[model samples]
Target chain A: MYRYDEFDERFVRERVAQFRDQVNRRLSGALTEEEFRPLRLQNGLYLQLHAYMLRIAIPYGVLSSQQLCQLAVIADKYDRGYGHFTTRTNLQFNWPKLKDAPDILDLLADVQMHCIQTSGNDIRNVTADQFAGVAGDEIEDPRPVAELIRQWSSLHPEFSFLPRKFKIAVIASQADRAVMKSHDVGIRIVRNKAGESGYEIFAGGGLGRTPMVGKRVREFLPKGQLLAYLEALLRVYNLEGRRDNKFKARIKILVHEIGIDAFRDRVEAEFARADAFSDDENAELARISAQFEVRNYEKLSARSETFEAARKSDPAFAEWVAHSLFAHKVDGYAAVTISLKPVGGVPGDMTSDQMRFFADLTDRFSLGELRVTHAQNLVLPNVKQDDLHALWRELGKAGLATPNVGLVTDIISCPGLDYCALATARSIPIAQAISNRFADKARQDEIGPLQIKISGCINACGHHHVGHIGILGLEKRGQESYQITLGGDPTENMAIGELLGPGLAAGDVPAAIERIVGVYLDKRADGETFIETVKRLGVSEFKAAFLAGAQNEAA
Target chain B: MKLLDRNGFRTDDFSRAGADGAARLDAVIVPFADLPSTAARAGKRLGVDIPNTVTVEQLAPHFEKLALIGIAFPASTDGRGFSLGRRLRRAGFKGLLRASGPLIPDQFPYALACGFDEIELPDASAARQPESQWLQALGAITLPYQRGYARPSSIFEQRRQARKEAAHG
Candidate 1:
């Protein structure tokens, strides 16, 4: 966990003061609503359907226990006693009053957090793999670099107002847990031919109105030149990206319009010309890396007697461990993913009590730090294997022991029409219906490794484009209709899911998903995943099955 | 409109004239679109009022003869002018760099940091936000993080300097 120094503290405090003054001016009618709109948005306050939604930036999705507790206090004090975690690993409060926004930001500043750039057209909060440092397969911890980007992009003088929102994701593994190829910029830590670790950069990948997978802009960028290259990229985008239509403003659209080669050439030219970069970036990196290197583990055997005994005795505990535990970098620890996707619950919504309890659980079982996964789950990054069962019991007490990480019922969803003004249809109900349909743990296990992501609109906030079974909700003729797409994968082999058939009524979505699963089970070769089966057998079979299910459900 | 620089609010000496006006040696600024039409009067005290999207390549030839260049912000939130100003300075434009629009007090420091010599505010904003508030906003951020800006230097540079001094000591 990175702590704020005097400069960082002063920076956040000044930002809070600035926002408070803006809010006061807006209240006093000194500033018109039109003028205040971009200001509030840059501070991450959205005028949602019911109320103002304040999105707090969990920079790179890492949070200290103290920070989580402060968030809990804010949730209890201002919001509806709960907050929803977004697909970008941000926490969004759907009901914060406009008057209380400045106070809430003041509270956030009490910790080392603010909502800056969370929803603005500028470069948004940078994201990285949830399991950044502790993952067994990591090439290097990406937190230090993520922190670097966080500071550099904060209130950036040159790029404060971009054509549209830009998202940057970093990952250090071949596993691609952070949806690297689906961001505007993706930085993957890789070793070049000389065996020195550098970045393999990708550009223009985004999922929204028009989904695009990023193309490799640089084969290997030296770690030292990351910020300089990013500044060059931002400069080119600010200068020439489309501003005629707001929808066609993202850097993705620019790359798609001019083609990647020309974009690369322009960016390289700007990088060569721009010479205002800092001379002590390595020293700054060393300072940041030291914060992420605070892993303290007691020397213990790889095999935990207590963990094995609990697994052998309790079938429930064993099932939870099998689904939720990830291999850690240390021999005697396991990174536990406490799933927010409970059966028949809204995905990624955590109650204030759950936040407080989870905060305490992190301090007790793992380090005092945790991560928010892009899948809308919480991660205990360095939980000792010896304390697995005790921690599991504590988690079960708070309903955080869902044990459905990457399972069929573990769906990702947005706030949808229930909360979001942009949503055309309801997504939470659809997610709840689908999760309840596949509620049986045994059935979910039988239908293994299925991701059913639902979005209330085409903005893809739910990341439905990357789900194995992508469900997009659209309003057709005053009725909610859901479109299904198959073979969507979020891993290294990223592909935009293909549409299965015409839109089905909302009531038919879960049954349609069940039929799609049947198609996968029947068509899959031995030991093939659902995505593998969809790729090998193609979406045609799934489309046939889906249409048949629609007819049957209607009948 | 009033001109705000580090020296405080001042009166403007130049007039914004159209391309149809006869070229004179007096300080006259025209819209950037009219630069080609006014190229014949290059020896005059010519200036260009350009949008933020204007490229340095377009203005490079006129840098020698131009007395001033004003980049439009249009709206307070549109920050394309900041990068344009930085680019112009880096491209060796030695003339005055002016940010022209309805900019608020908060953006004053950023304008200065991006190589703007002064801010030309529309009359409405100049009256609405007090000059005292503008002065206060100038010192609002005593320390900024990025380098290559005007003093005080970036916080990172300060840290690096401290580290070097410590190493030698």
Candidate 2:
């Protein structure tokens, strides 16, 4: 965890004071709503359906225990008893008075956090892999670079008002846990043939009413030039990106219109003119990197015997070990994922008490550090292997010990019509129905790794585009319907799922999913996964089964 | 001949005449596209021969002859003109750098740092007061771009090295 230095602290404090005055002006009628909308949005306050929703930034999905406790306090004091963690690794409080938002921002600034650039048309919070420093397979931790970008893009004068909201994600490993391919700008950290780490930049990727996979703009950009390259790309986008139609205003549309070759040429020309690469940028990066150096770990011998004995004595513990535990670079340590989706609860809601419990547990079992994954789960990155038994006991007592990571029931859902003002149909009910359908533990284990993502609208907040079985909610003639898609995956081999015939009524959506799974079970070859089976058998078989029931109803 | 400040008090020695009278060369601020018409009228009537300049354009062409250059800020938050002022100074423009059109006193330090010599505040009473604590808290801080210019003297380098070594120790 990087503590805020004096400069960082002062910056956030000044920004908070600035926003406080803006809010006062808006309330006093000195500033009209039209004039104040972008300012408030840049501070992460949105005028929603019934009230204002304030999204607090959780940079790079990393949190200290103190910060988590502060968030719990915010939820208890100002909002409903819980807050919803979003796919961008931010948190949204659905209820906050417009006047009280400044106070909330003031409190967040005390803890080295602010809501700046969480929304509106600007460079948004930069996201990276949740397990950046602790993951064993990483080329290098990407958080230092992510922090540099966070500092550079915060309240940038030249680019505060862009054509549309822009998102950037970075991944340092071969396995794409951050879904870098679907962002507006994706940077993959890799080593070149000469054994030096650098980035492979991708451009023009996004998902909304339109979906695209980013194209490779630079095959191997030297690490020293990351900030300069990004400046050039953003300058080009800000100057020439379209403002004609709101729907066609993203950088993705601009890149598509100009063609990748011509866009690259323009970016190169702008890069030449900007003089972006200076010694100051390198010094800033070095300072940020020093703040993120790995903490000291106690040397301990690997205790396979104790772990094996505990697993042999308890079947429940064995099941948990199979799913919750991940390998670590260090010998006697492990990465533990705390699943938020227990049987039928809300996808990413944690009670204030549960948050406190996790904070305490992180201080005890882990190194007082927590990571929030884009899948809406939390990570205890450096938990010692020998302390697994005690951690499992504490987690079980707090109801945070769900032994279903990446299982069919560990769904990734959004706060749908129940909370979001942009939603057109109910997503929580559909998610609940499906979870209840697969409530049998044995059935879930047998189905193995399946990702069921549901979104209430085409905005894809739930990331239904990348799910293995994606369900998108829509309102068809005053009735809620869910459209199912098959074979979408968000890993390195990313692909958008295909639509499986007509949409199903809300009540019938779970049964339709069961039928599709049943078809997969019948047609799967030996040891073939659901994705592989779908690839081999194609969508025709599943489409026939899905549409057969709809035809019968039509008849 | 005088111009009104944002508080409706006279400050600068420039005035705008009506359409019936001939324009004077005390210094007039006009848009970039109206330069040719203003210049022709000034040459015809006042015979106050000086090069006429437009606000918010490249200053390279008028750097030598112009005594005053007006830079326009369309809105308070739009800061493109600040960069323009910096560019003009970097190109060796030492004339009167006047900021015009919606410029405010709260942005005085930033404008001054970017090389603006005078501010042509708008003539609105409500815009006269300092909006917030921005003025009270305004002070100099180390800018990211300042190091590029402060490196010619060896004494500066020695002081920087001493500070670095002390911090490391």
Candidate 3:
């Protein structure tokens, strides 16, 4: 909800001007495609399979109603009237021309938004918890820190040309909502014994060809020294990280190659060395924190009588109530997660009408704000519990109420061979088939808290490696084969899932998942979730049944 | 090679050292491998050309004798030189810093901000992106958000000043 000031506005305007010039240069043969690739990518413009996809950065996943409306306008004007929300908390338009890019950037800057650092080898758009200020488990709001980082990393002269893409995530909660351990740098806000706020830093975690859980670099770094420490860490990585192989260029490889302790030593030595540019210590931090927009939450009874009555009266609403609501720190408010996955719809795809509808609802049902989740859903961060039924009714009319947040059918998928030039096969269609297979509401509720993540390739944009039921699509022997991995977790105790034997045919994937779920249902103890059962009985127990059924389906 | 400072085109001041060594009274640019020989002669102003990978710690010993450092960027995108330049400056290298590569006009600002006094481009790159384009690129953004070599106050400090003025007024 923080609005851009004159300086920020001027900054974005100048960036748009700069990008426009770059585009002109590329058009006139002043810059080659090879030369202009990184430049265009930094502006969030990617040439996809058939067309140019324009990605817009919603910094830290927070967007104002006005900004959301503007996105709808752009989607209608430039794109094919729809936008896909990416797992990185970005929105992408699959069909945009190169000429229209600068105008689109100008439109984004009008709403205090720009696509800078959304892609490319530079430090990417910073991400944080979707339920930052409203979550019950929060220690401190991470938005201020996320914004400060965004400002500091924006056009960083020393770090703009990193060996590979760098991602940073911030969270201030016991519940890891931002996939904290899976980023290049993960910062968790904490208070020490003396009651001073600090950070617990994680370094070098990523999922690409090789998946890894980031090691904790600093147990407790003083909050004020975060930027300086990050600068030191990046300087060491810039100087020492491998550039020989493109696939192995991520900071995770460096941390894995040289042990975390050695990496930490180099970072600490650099940190203690002569400070080149001491980051805007606490002065800029205070300013951002003050501008983080405190909500004037209305005081009311803890239980909303209307919400209670609606839950008892309407089964459809009750079914949605079970999974959609997250506990808010404020007594009378609840964070409502609006699922972009509706039955068998394209996961994370939102029509222009849906965008406009959601923007309107943000003003009426909640405050004039919303947050995009890493799971490709949207969260109304601070909705009054009293307006539960009204919000649900509005959502139902727009096909936004799916009643599946963490359920079996709620999947994370990437636009694969259909759009991405890097993909081996299609991911969206597979996600659709699985969602339709598990469409039975009763079955979905029975298999609760199951994450089915699918990535078309090993880039893992869909985050299959961290998924509870990971499906990786690989092209084997000129055929699309899906490899299944089990027992992966994305929390503090993060683990990479293990492979479940050989890859399955495309048609056998849904049947294989069904058999695996059947195995879980049979083996689970009382009230055990899918991941819990997998953890308890080991993934091997379900393997025999899954492989047996998958073989039968393929034959 | 084209040598460019913030103002415009510039001529090379230091002549490249030969295999024998540098002239005692002349400004000489010696290769990294030939530094030991050149430094012993104690020229009027000694400069070394080294790859970006060389650490500031490795170069710190020669700070007193060295007057210039030309960092080799094998590719424009290999940003190790920028970080190395900053590290050298922070480690008390007061001599001139030069970024040598085929970098575009777009990268000129980053080079300057990272403590490079000038950039030396290969002949082909200089022909492709002439001095006019590079000079225009310098003024692309009159003011940027972050602080660099010579800039006193960033937008952050500017904001603080505005806030102070608001409070006092």
Candidate 4:
């Protein structure tokens, strides 16, 4: 993880002071609520349904043990002793006082963190793969580049107030974990024919009211020209993106309207003209790269006898290893996933005590660092193979050792109508119900890698658009209606899921999901995943099964 | 509307010119739509106030003809004007460039850095966020991380200089 230098520290301190003044002005009647709204939103404070919610940016989803400790302290002191980690890999304190926001920001700054650009139309926190450096199939670690972008886009003079919120996600691995194709700009670090690592830039990809898989504007952009290329793309979007309707203001809509060919031409022209990058930027990248480089790993055997013995002794530990462990680039090291989804718990909510315990575990087992996944889980990116059993035991003590990483029970949900002012229906209860229904580990394992994502509203904050099984909750005629979409893949083959027939009542969602799963299990071959089964059987079979279940449930 | 620059409040030296050339103030701000019909006045400081919709190419040719260019930000959240300002500067507009809108004081540094020599705030906005607040807001962030803007020194440049000094020292 990159530590904040003096410049970065001073920058955050000033920003906190600036926001403090703004909050004061807002309270003093010097600034109207309308005037103060964007100011507060820029600093990640939102006026939610019952109270103000403060979102803290976990930059690139990476956190040090010390930072985690600070987050726990803040949660205990300012919030209701818990913070909900969002799908963006950021954390939201649901009940922070409006006046205490400045204090919270000051606390975040102490840990080299701040909530700047977490919300609003500004270029939001640039997210990268949680397994960036540690992943087995990575082309290169994207954290250094992600950090450079974070600096470049932070309080950007020319682009602070874009037509709409823009999100950029970078993924270096061939296997997409960061939902790259569904961001405003998705950068896939790729190698050219010459075997030099470069970026494949995808623009106009976003998922909100209008879901779009990004269109590739540039096939291969030199790694050196990353900032310049990004600036050119943003400049085109900033100048040309529609401001007529708020819903149609995203770069996706602009790209969709003008076509990618014309958009590419304009961007290429702008790139030719704009002197966006300098030698200083290259130097900064070098400094950032040095920070991400880990040179302290000891070479060890790939197989660990202790790990084998632990697995033989405990079946639960063995299951956890199969479900939660990811292949590490280094020998004897595995990336361990600490699942936040215990059965019937809120998808991403972690209590203050859990934060402290998780931090202590990270300090002991995983090089004192952890990464928050977009799927609402924490990842210990460098756990030794021998320590897996010990870590599992520690995690089990805190109910963190859930052997359902990509299974149906491991759901991604939003703070819907219960907290979010924008939400029309409840999502947490729906998530809880589904999790309880699929509490059986064997059943979830049988379901096999089904992503059940729920959103309280059409904003898709829960990323319902990309889930294998997306459930969007909408309020229709004062009744909560849940709409199901099948085969919504967020991987390299990204597509918005198709709507399967009419909406179901909120109470009937789990039954509908069960029928869908039942259909999948019935039709699936020996090794077919839920998505693979859906693809093979088509949406029509699932729809037939769903309708049949709905009729039976109504009876 | 109060016209403000790096200096406090300044008198408006420009005005809008009509097609007939009968309605001309000291320095005229010709609207983009009216530019084709309105003949350019020699010795008169001609300026164009462009909407966010206008492209840089549409206004590039007039860079030499205009003494000042005003970018209209209809709303504070609509940031097209910021890009427009940078484009105008890149297009070699040597004269005064102004951001005219109901912008907040928080945007003072952005406006200056984006090549805006002055800000023309609506009377109500000016009354709400006075010159003192704007001045205070300008220094809120001591250094910006960006390059190629109106700022004297960006943080990137400063850091590079410091690094060089440390090597020598």
> What fraction of the correct interface contacts does each predicted structure contain?
0.51, 0.01, 0.55, 0.79
Candidate 1 vs 2: which has more lDDT: 1
Candidate 4 C-alpha error for residue A418, in Å? 1.2
Which residue pairs does candidate 2 place in steric collision? none
lDDT of 3 by residue, B1-169 (tens): 8899999779978777773454644788888887766554443788899998898878898888888999999987799998999999888899999998878888888888888999988888777676888888887766667644445556766876776788799
Tens-place lDDT per residue, model 2, A168-202, is: 99888999889898899999999999998889999
lDDT of 4 by residue, A4-86 (tens): 78889899999999999998877877677888888889999998899999999988999999999999999999989999999
Worst 10 residues of 2 chain A by lDDT: A273-282
DockQ top scorer:
4
Judge candidate 2 against the unseen true structure and give its global Cα lDDT, from 0 to 1. 0.76
Q: Give the alpha carbon lDDT tens digit for every residue of A1-555 in model 3.
A: 667778888888999999999998888777778778889999999988999998899889999899999999999999999999999999999999999999999999988999998989999989999999878788888999899889878878789889999999999987787888999999999988998888999999999899989899998987668778888899999988899889989999999999999999999998897344433456677778877766578997889999999999999999999999999888888999999998888988989998989999999877889999989999998889999999999999887888999988889999988889899988999999999999999888878889999999999999999899999999998999999999989887788998998998888899889888888989889999888889999988788988788677668
The lDDT values for all models are 0.87, 0.76, 0.88, 0.88
Docking class of 2: incorrect
RMSD (CA, Å), each prediction: 1.9, 5.1, 1.8, 1.9
**lDDT of candidate 3 at residue A425, scale 0 to 100:** 82
| Model 1 chain B weakest 10-residue run by lDDT | B18-27
Per-residue lDDT for B45-131 in model 4, tens only?
Answer: 778888877887888877777788888989888888898888888888899998989888888889999999999989988877767
Q: Per-prediction DockQ, in order?
A: 0.62, 0.13, 0.63, 0.77
